[model samples]
Target: MSLVKESREELNLIPQVMHSLINACVGMFASAYHQAENKKQNLLRTDILTEQFKRLLLRHIRTHKSTSDYAESLNISPAYLNEAVKLTTGFTVGFWIQQATITEAKRLLYTTDTTVKEIAYLLGFTDHAYFSRYFSNAAGHSPTEFRLTHRK
Candidate 1:
């Protein structure tokens, strides 16, 4: 008779113990899930900022040549903009700006018969000599050289 009563008591305690264990497991899972969600949201926000920065760069590459310029337009700090862009695209903001400038310069050089000085001015460079040096450094050739070699 004592053994039967003890067994009944143990059986009654099992439900309470199981309920506590289940609640703990649920709490842990919920915490992990919320953490994952927050991380995903942060990454998504960074990606959006990166895309916005790229669009601004393309639209204002000729006029806005500085990282601060684009960062200001996007309402973000230059450091944060660069960090977000670098994280999402694996490159800095200045790199994309330079690429946009050089790509446009190349297109104009290849397709038009504009003088190098005129091309430099069109690209928002105040000095043709400086433009030439910049182009040479980024493109591995002078503007005139690129035109001559690339133009058939």
Candidate 2:
């Protein structure tokens, strides 16, 4: 074997493991650098998302409406709302809306003895399949699985 192979054999690690470890280290370093940049940007523009987030949270928790509705309520275009949300939360307006709705759905599924259809409509999804699809996409499981996990 070569010197490199000998060194790796001494450490009981394969060449692939060494490459993977180096890649993981680089990934972690890049993540930390990006996080620091994000922190600096947030410090420079604190609460810039407060109004929009507040409006979003209120309209969402209260009514769980669509992004277009929220953007119209805020009197800006949907694109602008999406941009604001991305700047504020690292997510688009639609993402937050869908995720928030799914979160509420999870809460109901885990805490209440409610039917999936009822919870679906309660969270503003006109159809149960739509709610199920959205919930599964966000939680990596179906609402029934979620409920089963948390059943009392």
lDDT over C-alpha atoms for residue 42 of model 1:
75
Q: For model 1, what is the C-alpha lDDT against the true structure?
A: 0.92
Which lDDT tens digits does candidate 1 get at residues 47-143? 9999898888888878998889988998989999999999998999899989999999999999999998999999899999999999999999999
Clashes of each: 0, 0
Could you tell me the TM-score of candidate 2?
0.62
TM-score to native of every candidate shown: 0.71, 0.62
Number of the top TM-score candidate: 1
Error of 2 at 57 (Å): 2.7
Q: What ranges in model 1 sit over 4 Å off?
A: 1-43
Worst 10 residues of 2 by lDDT: 44-53
Tell me which residue pairs clash in candidate 1.
none
> lDDT at 66 for candidate 2?
67
lDDT of 2 at 37: 95
CA deviation > 4 Å runs, candidate 2: 1-50, 62-64
